[model samples]
Target: MTTRFFLTSAATTLLAAIACGPAHAAPDLEAAQAIVDEHSQIPTFEPPGEPFDAKACMADKKLFSVPTSSSIPFVDGIETSMEEVAEEIGFEFQQWKNQAQPTQWVQGMEFAINNGFDGIDLMAGIIPSSLGPQAAAAKAAGIQVFATHWADTTTPDDPAATHSFPIPYTRVGEIIGAWITVKTEGKANVLIIGSDDVPATTPYRKSVQATLDKLCDGGCSHTYVNVPVAEWATKIQTNVQGALIADPTINYIVPIYDSMSQFVLPALTITGKKGQVKIATFNGTPFVIDLVRQGEVEMDIGESLGWIARSTIDAEMRSLCGLDVPEDLYVPLLIFDKDNAETAGVPAGFNQGYGDEHVSGYRKLWGLE
Candidate 1:
């Protein structure tokens, strides 16, 4: 495990205090709006490193991926896209379908090791720490285990995986904070919802809380609540309802992950706060982006699945081929709101709107174009 990736006990305590800290008196609206404007544009692809013979490097390599849940559209999309990339690169790719269970993940790892796979990737929301022995066994068998789109770049990488493609989740959190500040003109009252079980959420929440404190100062206020993944269906709506009842002034509900928006939408409708309180979340999941178009969600931070697939493949191939792998996946984030939700698609399409900069850029880097 990289020491830089894990938070110390003191740092964790400090971040907790900051996240729940009291509000200040005024907000720097200008600064908040500046952040919103800067991040709202379509992001371009920047090469993570100099070009290499990715196709050659990937020749005869076998890759398998196990997602947290095959049912999740976001995770499904990325894995499906990865398979497509592997096909184009002329390497064998397989997916181990599972229902977000650690046992299933262990089975997937065992399959990869026994079947002579060159690499295996544990996709979003699947914690590596929970599979320590399985991961160690795979590494022992010379299978390079990877955790992709799981932990944030700021958090320490779990030693279970040989490598990880840390996503910029904290940056997304900060962007959400800025959007909230700008939308409310610096006096926003927010209900911040998250699942503490997801390792990525720690830095994500920390980033949002820190951004709100710096940009809104004491002008903005928020209440934080934890709804673990298993309890989201049963707890999120009621928890949100109770919070709204306690504080009618709350105008924004920010669930760290967009998938949680499903439960939150019901809460808003039940509380008659549908139009009163808006939602903004991470992940460009099509349905959630559709919510943005319908006015149910105010904004969303999007990372195209196709781009993520290419970036993950690029990084993994580099590492496996004994090239220097990037410290993090260079996936670009785009913001979707009422002004631009239609560009993603009238009803929103998976992997649409983010442009093909990655497609062309990666092809060039891989010497495919």
Candidate 2:
């Protein structure tokens, strides 16, 4: 399935309205509005002390000729950044999807190595066990490794696990918790949902729990619901339906990612409480943005644009070019709600951008303009 990225007119209008409104709106709305305003503002960077020649970087023939493998298909922000990077530097890029499975991650890594790619952009879903070995094999093969959307298990001691960046999972959790507490007035009975098996998701869970413990003085009530990898949709629908049926008073629902929230929507419908329950999800995909606009989802923490993709490319390109590498790099985060979801650029699922203008802003930061 092809995924297009872009912001919508509705989102733009919503942002404009929020921008004109008072700063102290509803907590969720205010937080979302702040993000929109921040993104819209141009940064004033200090003038370069040394003349950094973009042409010099571009003229590096080795960088242009390097072949790289991306962990996932070019569909979302990752793909968009990769395309822009490739276009700017003229590198040959290949993409492989692990289908959100552990086994596929191993296969994809092995395939990239065998295919003689200079670097690998590992975007596999969070599977800790698979990551170490894959990073090891890639390092052993001397292939540059860049990872996105997944945590890197490689420590300083492990040569095989060298040069990786992780998304700020803990920060994301904290952001979600802060938004939820503000929205629910510190009295939230939240249903936190995500896969328990993946190590990457564990930080988010811990972060949310920690934030609740620290921030909610009265002690916010919450339940961690593990969504099984297989039959997740069916299970989420059933579980949420049962939860609502069992306790009609339940108010808050927090999904780690918005795509997973789709499954729980049916449950809310079945319980005849679709709009009554508040939802705060991560990843401001188009669907979640619509839910927020319609008041179904109270808030969301948007994944930063191009950060994941650019970090992945940076890791691989640095390795290929023999540059100094860091152990980990983290992408920034954006919080979204009804007020700002439309402004921050909604995902493709919401029929927003027409592709051309979708990721141009973020791509511009990477010198992909």
Candidate 3:
């Protein structure tokens, strides 16, 4: 299938995973309004340094990237960045295929270490505990490993495992929850589907729950179901169906990542809950942007995969070259809704952040120009 079609298929098959994977309004309306208002505007990240020598830094270098979910659109974006950057800088960039499970990532690391890849990029879903001995092996083999999104960040600093960036997942949760509160006038029944396998998702889930609990207090209620990423494809629909069936009062279905829309939307259809429940989530993948624009999704708090891809590549490459890395090398998220989807969302087929100058921004930083 074509790459675009493949992403759509994957988006459907993967909704989000082994994984796992809000409210609005009130006198507290001020806070919720602020959350939405702040994100309503586009976010830009300009590097804070002069260009370094890219040719010298990447000369004869090679890297392997292990993505937790190759089928996910966000992962596709990261791979695009790696390939584009690799082509421009003359480095060998190889990515493991269809690594949708945690175990596959561990094995990918072992392959990278054994096969002499110079660096490793840890995409969001690869857990730290799952690394087993591969991390040490990579370090021992003189490989530089940089992580972004959701790799276990608790470890004491390791040179090989150096450099990590942000997505502000907790804030993402808070914003979604607040949006829910505002929309329902602080009285929405929410069914939240999440993945237990993704540890980072824990905080996002908790923050959302906390927001609902705090804002609604006695007025609103939410039921949460956690599944692992490995089983998300098979379990998400059933789990969500069960939650809705058990409590038919559920008026909102919140999938932490917008990609989950693929799975959730169909489940809502099969369960005959389509259009009965509203959706609002994160990642604002291209499809999600369209969903928000078409009014299929109520809100999408989005981080541009295009921006993420570029930011992640710059972080990994710079760390590989021993340049100054920003403490927050993350691309910020923008909030999307019917009012702003037309302008706030990236144009369809334009790549997540194709409008941005991040490539040139990084090039100036690396003296690649």
> Which of 1 and 2 is the better model by TM-score?
1
In the range 171-235, model 3's lDDT, one tens digit per residue, is: 88888888888888778899888877765677888888898777665456888888766666788
lDDT of 2 by residue, 218-273 (tens): 44677787875555656888888888888777888887767667788888888898
Clashing pairs for model 2 are: 6-353, 11-342, 165-329
TM-score winner: 1
The lDDT values for all models are 0.87, 0.58, 0.73
Q: Give the candidate number with the greatest lDDT.
A: 1
Model 3 segments beyond 4 Å from truth?
A: 1-27, 48-50, 151-160, 343-347, 350-355
Instruction: Put the candidates in lDDT order, highest first.
Output: 1, 3, 2
- The runs of at least 3 residues in candidate 2 whose Cα sits more than 4 Å from the true structure, single-residue gaps closed, are 1-77, 128-135, 152-160, 345-369
Q: Could you tell me the TM-score of candidate 2? A: 0.72
Q: What are the clashing pairs of model 1? A: 5-155, 5-156, 6-156, 23-218, 24-218
Task: Write the candidate numbers in order of decreasing TM-score.
Answer: 1, 3, 2
Against the true structure, candidate 1 has what lDDT? 0.87
Worst 10 residues of 3 by lDDT: 18-27
